[model samples]
Target: MKLENYNVIGVMSGTSLDGVDLAHIQFRIKDKKWDFTILESETIPYDLTWVQTLKTAVDFSQIELEKLNQEYTSLLASIISDFITRHKIENLDAICSHGHTILHQPHNGFTLQIGNLPEIADLVQQTVVCDFRVQDVQLGGQGAPLVPIGDRILFPEYDYCMNLGGFSNVSFEENGTRIAFDISPVNTVLNFYANQFGFDYDDKGQISASGEINEALFNELNNLDFYQQNYPKSLGFEFVKETVLPIIESFEIDITDKMRTFTEHVALQIAQALPNKNGRLLITGGGAYNDFLIERIQFHLPSIQIIIPDNKILEFKEAIIFALLGVLKLRGEINVLSSVTGAETDHSSGNIYQPK
Candidate 1:
């Protein structure tokens, strides 16, 4: 299938604080069918200072956050330019960036993504599409779990699409309606603890497997009110620090024990989201690399078939979806799902910036 000029760079910085994923992809829609080829992909890890700033920015005042937003935009422009130059990319269509989500307290009717500066378009010399979640939030939506629209469009074969990145979010088609919700914390909380041991992440779930589960903490996490609140719900770092951290800190458990119990919690929550016992599930994001976590989830739901594709897909699934969202926006199609986000209506979302 062939379509008119369909190439893009998809940029994503997830809440996990892992890194920026840049995927140069070629997408074609012919006769209402969509296909894509990943021409190049790379992940650039955040510097220690940037990581620290992002982690602590939640506590900053409004002025501080404003400055940080500008600084973050500058950093994004620089990194994106480097990526484009390194790949010698040309014949470009647009750069679709899911900017680093800084503040996501959508119940207050606002959401902020920090790296959508017009300077990025000037620096990269390309059309840019970003700031995807605010409109939905304004319309009384969760302003998250936005990938479900792409899941429905691009990977319709899988009965469920689960992404385990900063957060665990699952999406699937149920009764001809697409539904999704954030299940639990993932790399965000795990990496927070892992950093104490001087490791960016628990490689292949080694640290978690070696740890013992703190039964008290495990039960507390399982019984959290959020878990029982029902679907169309989302989570952010605020939820982590305000709700999760305090609960975990109340117990005098070792770091390894905390990891173990949290891993169990994540697995159980994810397993519970499966709509059908025997349906095929496509799992992506950094959590898919956690063998121990996968073991626990599989143990919990033995009948479901869990499939993990290549490392690129696992890492850049969200980035790819952001690119698809950009395509939908460019075509003036509905990219945000009302069912997934609890919005008043399904609609296209994002702002477009053309290079000056």
Candidate 2:
């Protein structure tokens, strides 16, 4: 049966390794429209043990990855259980999880999001909806930027929805269809450099602002082949490991200079990725807090206005959207867009597991 109202928990762990984000969300459908309110949300930072394991899981053999997946699923269940107990959250209809992205090379006809084991449903004793991207990839799509469906439905006012997470991805309506793609790397690269300086991140982009841009590095970064690709594309950590890191490490420049140049690259790429329209771009995720990066993006595209929402939305928007995706999947409505992902067709995607 189609549910008109649902109380669900949404979970997301981005590639930036920021840790697991969990949101207790309530979704309702009325007058042929859907709406959501985030009741509670929290982020559980991964310990060094899990972090090291996840960061290197891609290098593991198939058997090793399988073992890691089981371990991750156990960790996720415990986290969700703790959240529920701590918040006294009850009546949860489902748990919608994006899991951690370990390998995402969809062009090779496979993408893996661990912690999605079916045992999650049994462990949590709640219906679970997850593994949303595989079907789209199977149908010849990038199997990414799935959040655009939520953008089109929940936050339709903005001309573009830009998420600045591990990477930056933008979604906008063009010629009556929603077009979205990964713009460039952001906090993933920034934080990696920041870690070298004994900081978790370049707080408020201060490190980046304190340095001068290397025109040479900036030019080379702007010339990366990914920038020339058309839409219906996505990025994974593999690209950063193979392409971005090598290019950045090749420079003998100071850490500050590298930060400044890479920050400039991010801002320039984002400015260029946006449609040349005169409207607001709703920016969210961790990068929205980077004042220096935002300044450069604004400097590059003075015509387009950038808007950031409250902290809850900023930190948990993706989690909230994953909740909405699960709701759509339960209703058997289209949640994945072929127009955005280049799939064979628009379809509702996600596995539904009922606890015994």
lDDT, candidate 1, 90-125, per-residue tens:
878889999998888877887888998777788778
**What digit string (tens of lDDT, one per residue) describes model 2 on residues 1-356?**
57788999999999878889999999888887878888999999999788778878878899998999999999999999999999999989899999999999988999999999999999999999999999999999998989999999999999999999999999988898999999898988999999999887899999999989999999999999999999989999888888998999999999999999999999989888886756898999989999999999899888988899999999999999999999889888999999999999999999999998
Instruction: Please state the error at residue 100 of candidate 2 in Å.
Output: 0.5
TM-score of 2: 0.98
Clashing pairs in 1: none
**Model 2 spans > 4 angstroms off:** none
Candidate lDDT scores, in order, read 0.90, 0.92
The parts of candidate 1 lying over 4 Å away from their true place are 1-5
At residue 77, candidate 1 shows an lDDT of 88
Best by lDDT: 2
